[model samples]
Structures are given as C-alpha cells and as structure tokens.
Target: MAKRIDVADLNIYYGETLAVQDVSMSIEPRSVTALIGPSGCGKSTFLRSLNRMHELIPKARVEGKVMVDGQDLYAPDVDPVAVRSQIGMVFQRPNPFPTMSIYDNVAAGIKLNAKRMRTSELDEIVERSLRQANLWDEVKDRLDKPGTGLSGGQQQRLCIARAIAVRPDVLLMDEPCSALDPISTQKIEDLITELKADYTIVIVTHNMQQAARVSDTTAFFNLRGIGQPGQLVEIGDTATIFSAPANKATEDYISGRFG
Candidate 1:
C-alpha cells in the first residue's frame, strides 16, 4: 500500500555542521513531490532523510520527526533497516549491482527480507518488478546477464526494479535522470509519472522543467551563503509554483535569474 509522509521541524546534520534545517512538509500518498533547489542546497540530503539514508554517513544524525502513517520513523524501537525496506530509494546515478544478474538484482531485496520463498514466487516477483519498471520486455531474454550490461537507461530501470521488488510503500529518487541522455531522460520521466499511481514518490532534481512536468507538488530549497544550512523556501502545487510562485526566490530560480 502507498503511504503518506509528514516531516516536522526536521534538521539534518553531519557531526557539528547542520546541512538541512527545519524542513516540514507533507508528501501525499499516490502522488509525486519534487524537491528543487540550487547545488549544495541540501535537496539530496533532505531526500535521503526521508528513508533514514542520510544517517548512514559518519557522524550524521537528524533532530526532528519523520512520520509515516502516524508512526514516527525515528522512535526508539523503530529499526532503520525496516524503515529502509518500507521506503526504498533510487539514487542519482544508475547503480545496478555489477556482480548481480538482472534477475538477481531485483530478487536481492526480496531474498534478504524473506528467508524462505519458492523459486516460482521469486521468479514472479522479479518479472512483476521488471515489468513495473518497464524493463521486462527488453531483458526477459537475458535474465542471467549482468545488470551492468544493459544500456544506461535500462540499467536505471533495473535499479528501479530492484528498489520496487520488495514492495516499498514510498520511493525516493535523487536526480534519477540526470545521468541519462535526453531520450533516456524522457523514458525515466514517463516511468516516474506511471510509478506515482502505486508509490508515494519524492524526487530531488536540479532540472526545474522536469519537476514541473512530473510532480503534483514542488518544493524549493536554498541556502543563505556558502557555509549556511539549506532551508525550504516555499512549496505548493506545481502549476502555481511555475506560474506565480509566492516566494521571490522561487520565481527567480524558475525564471533562470539565479540559482
């Protein structure tokens, strides 16, 4: 099932330095939300915090609440691993496991979470996930081939397949199309549009037009200066953000006036 996320007064830090500061937003289920910002504005850092991925960095931590369907993700008893399983992530670059075959890449998450499963069941899941990622028809003939063997776009879709195989309720994508060619980027944009029907998606993208095209809601993050922590400037419907943003900074950024 898809899930909604509510972040309240969230602050992300790397040891003594705060990276993203006081972000609060509600990400609706079955919809796409895009985070847009200048480089070094903590857009990716904020995205990682959604699934506890940010804390994986040395001395990284968060101070605030990230709630999903009323459960606090940072509660004392909540497991980070389990949190990750429920909220899967696809990174900026296509990072399909080089050593794993296409089928194994998708099956890896499922197998880790389920100790015992019939081969038939595993096969079904891999097929379904690949299909969901729109990569099944292209690679069904070579399931045993290394995942890296695919084209850049196919590899990214395979990564998406791997992320979705475990049936996560929410998906986090960080510049998932930045490394692709224009045609490949279009395919990914199309895939992202389709995926939101089943998964709550939050994407961080430097491309303003991509955000406007793919997201129901858009958020703009910015920093005061080089060493300053990044903060959310404004958030609203994509149309409104593009047409007549309430914040001057958002308007300026959208109009290519400044980063």
Candidate 2:
C-alpha cells in the first residue's frame, strides 16, 4: 500500500554547515509532489534526505523528524537498509548495471534481498514489472541482452522497472527526464502519471512546466543569498501555485523573471 510522509522541522547538514534549513511538509500517498528551485538551492539535497540517502555522504546528517505512515524512520532501532528498500530512488541519468542482462537488472534487488524463488517465479515478476514501467513490449524479446544496450528512453524505463520490482511504497526521482530527448521525456511523463496510482511519487525538477504538468502538489525552495541554507518558500496545490501563488517569490519564478 502507498504511504504518506510527514516531515517536521527538518534540517540537513554536511559536517558543521547547514544545507537545508527548517523544512516541513506533508506528502500525500499515491500522489505526485514536485520540488522546484534554482541551482544550488538544495532541492536535490532535500529529496535525498527523505529516504536517508543524504547520510551516504561524509559527515552528512539530519536533525528533526521524518515520519512515514506514523512510523519514525529515524528511530534508534530502525535499519537504514530496510528504509531504503521500501523507498526506491531513480537518479537524473538512466543507470543500468553495465554487466547485467536486462533480466538480471530487473531481478537484482529481489535477489539481493535474498528472496529465494524459482526461475519461473523470477520470470513472472520481471515481466510484470516491465509491463508496469511500460517497457515490456519494447524489450520482451531481448531479455538476455545487456540493459545498457537499450535506447536512452528505454533504459530509463528499465531503471524504473528495477525500482518498482521490489514493490516499494514510495518512489523518489531526481530529474528523471533531464537527460532524455523530448520524445523520451514525454514517454516518461506519461509513465509517471500511470505509476502514481500505486506509489507515493516525489520528484525534483528544474523545469517549471514539467512540474506543472505532472505534479498534484508543488513545493518551492530558495536561498536568501549565496552560501545561505535553502528553505521552503511555499507549498500548496499545483493549480494554485501556478495560477495564483500567495508568495511574490513564487510569482517571479513562475513568470520567468528570475529563478
């Protein structure tokens, strides 16, 4: 089942320096939420914090609370690995395991989690996941080929299949379409709309129009000045944010006057 996220007084830091400051928001389950901002405003950093990916960096840490369906993700006994398994992530670039076949790429997470299954069971899951990602028809005949051999758009869909194969409750994407061509980007946008029925989707994008088209909720982040920590400027329904934002900064950004 999809799960809601509640983040309160969240602050992310790299060593002694704060990167994202005092962000609080509620993310609805089975909906798309877009995070938008200028370069270096911590939009990506904030996204990573949601799944505890930020702490992978040296000296990176988080303060305050992040709750998913009333379970505290930062609790002392909670395992980060478990948290990550339930919250999948896709990067800006399509990254398929270079050495693995298309079949193995989709099956990697399940195998890594030590879920023993017969070959037929694995095959069924790989097919179903590929169908869900809208890639089965394109690659069904070449499951033995290297995943990296597909076109850029096809590769991204394969990555999405891999992320969803484990049945994750939440999916995090950081510029998933930024590296693809227009045709590919449109395909991905369509796929995102289809996936939200089963997973909580959160994406960080620099393209304002893409955000407006794909998201149900939108959050804008900004910094006061260079080297300043980024903070949430405003968050609300996407329609209202695009049509009649209550914040002047949001208006300026959506109007193309400034970023």
Candidate 3:
C-alpha cells in the first residue's frame, strides 16, 4: 500500500539549538521526493526527523506532528519501533553487517519483524527481495559469501534488499550513491525510480542533478542567516523547481548562483 507523509509546522532541536524551523510539507504517496541543500542546510536533519530517527541521537528532539498515512508517528502510545519498521532507511554509506552473508543480511529484517517461517518460505522471500533490489543476479551464486565481500555497489544493493525485505511503506535514503562510482550510482538511481511503484521515497541529496533525475518533487532548503536555523526555501514539482522556481533562493541555488 502507498502511504503519504505530512509534516505539520515541524521544528527540530539538538539540545538547546534549534536546527530546523517551521518546516511543513506533504510527501505524495508512492512518489519520490528529494530534499536538496548545501551542507548544514538541514536537509539531512529534516529527513531524519521524518522517521523519528533523529530522536535516537542524544539531545536530539523534534516538535509538531509527522503523519504517516493518517497516524501521528510521535503520538503518545505510538511505538517508534513500529513506526520505523513501517519506514526503513538506507544510509550515506553501504552498511551491511560485516560478518553476515548476503542471504543473511536480507533475511535479517524478516526475522526481526516476523516470527519463524518455513525454510522454503524464507528462501523465497530472500530471492524475491534481492531480485527486487537488482542484486539477485549478482549475489545469487555467492549467497553464503560475507556481505562485506561484495563491491561497494553490491553491498549497497544488499542494504537496499534488506530495507525492502520488510515491505516498508516509506524508504528514506540519505545519499545512498555518494560513495559509489558512476556506474554503481546509476544502478541505485534506477532502482530508486523503479521502487517508487510500491514505496514512498524521500532522499536527502547534495547532488541537484540526482534530485532532478529521480524525484517527482523537489524541496530546496537554505539556512536563514549566519548562525540561524535552516528553512524550506521552496517546494514544487521537479520541473517547476528546476526550470521556474517561485522562490528566488531556490532559483539561485539550482542555477549555481548562490547556496
């Protein structure tokens, strides 16, 4: 099922410092939304807040409602763990478990979210998930090989396979292609385009071309002033933001005129 994310007057704080201010936007269901900005502009911070992952950091906190589907993720009695399970994340770097095999890495999510299953059922899930991630043909012959043994691209694919194995409604990717070569980056990029059919994807990217290539919509973030918090400068369809942004700040940033 496709799920929409609505951020209502969101603010984020790290201890005493306000990192992001009054950001609000709606993420369309089963579509790709790219968050783009310069370093320290709060794109990554805002993305983390979407899944409540920011709360995992010491002294990190957020205010306002982040609705996934129709439920408030931070509401009292709502399990953050359950919320996270429904929304999976892929990091800036490929982070598959070093000691685990490729097959084990993908199966890990299923095992955590679900109880024991028949061996046949487990095999099928692993196969399907890896294939969906476009890693099956590459890693199938080496299913028992350690995940770390694969190339950076393959390891990244394994991580993606792991994320989707649990059938998450939203997938948050934090620069998943930053560490890879162009060919490898293209694979992950293509996979992101394809996966939007079943998952709402939010990406935090420093690469504007990447955002343009994969996103249905784009949000440009910029810091308000020296030492001040970051804010959303503009949000619109990918074509509109790239070609004729309503905000001068967004237009300047995309055109390399300013940050």
Tell me each candidate's RMSD, in Å, in order: 0.7, 0.6, 0.9
Runs in model 1 lying further than 4 Å from the true structure: none
Model 2 scores a C-alpha lDDT of 0.96
| Best-matching candidate per lDDT | 2
Q: What is candidate 2's lDDT per residue for 99-209, written digit by digit as tens?
A: 999999999999999999999999999999999999999999999999999999999999999999999999999999999999999999999999999999999999999
Q: Report the Cα lDDT for residue 142, model 3.
A: 90
lDDT of each candidate versus the true structure: 0.95, 0.96, 0.92
Listed in order, each prediction's TM-score against the native is 0.99, 0.99, 0.98
Spell out the clash pairs found in candidate 3.
Answer: none
- Give one clash count per candidate, in the order shown: 0, 0, 0
> What's model 2's lDDT at 235?
99
Q: Sort the predicted structures by lDDT, highest score first.
A: 2, 1, 3
Query: Which residue pairs of candidate 2 clash?
Result: none
lDDT of 3 at 117: 93
lDDT of 3 by residue, 122-161 (tens): 9999999999999998888999999999999989989999
